[model samples]
Target: MDLKNVDLNLLVVFNDLLNTGRVGQTAERLGMTQPAVSNCLARLRRLLGDDLFIRTQQGMVPTPYAEALAEPVSYALGAIHSALNQSVVFDPARSRQNFVIAMTDIGEIHFLPALMARLAAVAPGVSVSTVRNLSIDLPREMEAGNVHLAIGLLPDLQTGFFQRRLFGQHYVCLYRHGHPLDHPGGMTLEDFTAAEHVGVVAAGTGHGIVDDLLARMGVARRLRLQVPHFVAVGHILRNTDMVATVPQVLAQCIAGPFGLSWCAHPVSLPEVSIGLFWHSKFHRDAANQWLRAQIVAIRPDGVDGGRTEDGATAL
Candidate 1:
């Protein structure tokens, strides 16, 4: 694997081939002839000592080896692409840079509206994309510039990244307004544990702490349904007797639309700290700094407006 011997264009062809799985389609995307794509694939086959894609009647199916190489190669290409496209001067008002953020469904519901509103006012051309990758390695994605920032309570992102504390939140018991359980007195430990609950199986988030905290307190929830995300929880609670234990920010976000009410958790759950995480790799990238500033404004408490790790107070 001598880097000096390999052609960069071949890797680009390999990536597009791996995505499109056809010489003609790959050529169409890369603006090259089919022969050129096939030639590049040949060079890649010799370099890697494997037939990366096997052509079938349907399409080119990746071999086991190619499957293994797909993610890393895409990341490498993405890092190179990001590096090449980095702007020296980021004028948010006119720049059409699209920032990719990694967050959970909870963040989409809770953070996006405020963020987009701010972006529309200041940087109308700046676009945003959000990804919720529970299985993804956040650090690797950030390192490759695939994800510009991650907003959540991802403890896994603690090491090898710079983060700004956006807010800390506690769990709340959310249910419909007219439910039998909804009361001025709020949820008691008995109501929390005995009620049929919709347990959100949010794998890579701070909400997991709620279940752990309940376990420690010797409390049990009668889970009637389990879901992977929180976007549907409020809807479910609106129509069913099930209550959900979720972050206060999320509860607040969903409450109005679904006619829901939330109260203090009876079981004394610890506050889960949420933050804006970014790799130091793009700390000084002007576009990155500007986007980070917009996110800091949408903080749950909306007070802390300071310099990010990039050392930029405002764009």
Candidate 2:
């Protein structure tokens, strides 16, 4: 338990091994030799008094003890990184940082175009990449500095992280422009529930909330098609007869491009709150701060002084 006697560099190797699950891959990622990585693992196992990972046909699998240590180790490294780089200056135009953001396909359509354009004009040297929210261990990745920020209606991230509300949106039923349900007066409840629906069943996403709400109100959708994500919703709805209930921002972004249209949901559903999220470890990091500012500048009309029940507004 003596911090000065133990090599903290081994923890970096340990975290990489936890993520990659392969010694060779971890070595490559950390710019070390395979034997060096193996030595680090050995050192870590000795220091921790357990075999952290075991080799198997699948890959190097972490033991239960290692799984338990993942969060604390990641957080410790984050704090160490924050402390060491506190005085680093970030010049957006000169920096070649590639930021990884977590979001859904809905976010790509609604935000990326404007965001990329803004980056091109201001921080041309900087680039952005995205991973699907909730598809991976987002919290761990953020703590490990793998994911810089997450932009979406991510409830899981509301706690133990800092977030700034981007916007508030409601659900709208989307369909082809000339579909029968595309009426000016809006479709009645009976018609809405009876119509064949294109349901989105993305795991742990806010889209499922509306479905649960309908069920609570004793309304059932005739789900003719169920998709894992909203990436293909617009394309499918543009050519099909089925309608989908989605965030109003997503609908607006796709309606014109996909030859689609939307109307307010027939059933009352709570509003969706999108936010800009990052781990507290990177709250004051210059590069992270600049990235956040860029996102805010691109869409400043979002809730400036709003606070969510989860304390998710700029904390």
> Which candidate has the highest TM-score of all?
2
Cα lDDT, model 1, residue 4: 96
TM of each candidate vs. truth: 0.72, 0.86
- Model 2 lDDT tens row, 1-315: 888978989989988888888999888888899999999999889888999999999899999999998768867877888899889999988989999999889888878899999889888999899998666888767866789999888888844479887878899899998998787898789889789999899787667788788898999899999989998998899889898989898888889999998998888889887778999778768899888877766653543545542454544
- Against the correct fold, how does model 1 do in TM-score? 0.72
**Which ten-residue region of model 2 has the weakest summed lDDT?**
300-309
Clashing residue pairs in candidate 2 (N, C-alpha, C atoms within 3 angstroms): none
What candidate 2 gets wrong by more than 4 Å, as runs, is: 134-137, 158-160, 305-315
lDDT of each: 0.81, 0.84
Clash number for every model? 0, 0
What is the alpha-carbon lDDT for the whole of candidate 1? 0.81
Q: Whole-model lDDT, candidate 2?
A: 0.84
- Name the TM-score of candidate 2: 0.86
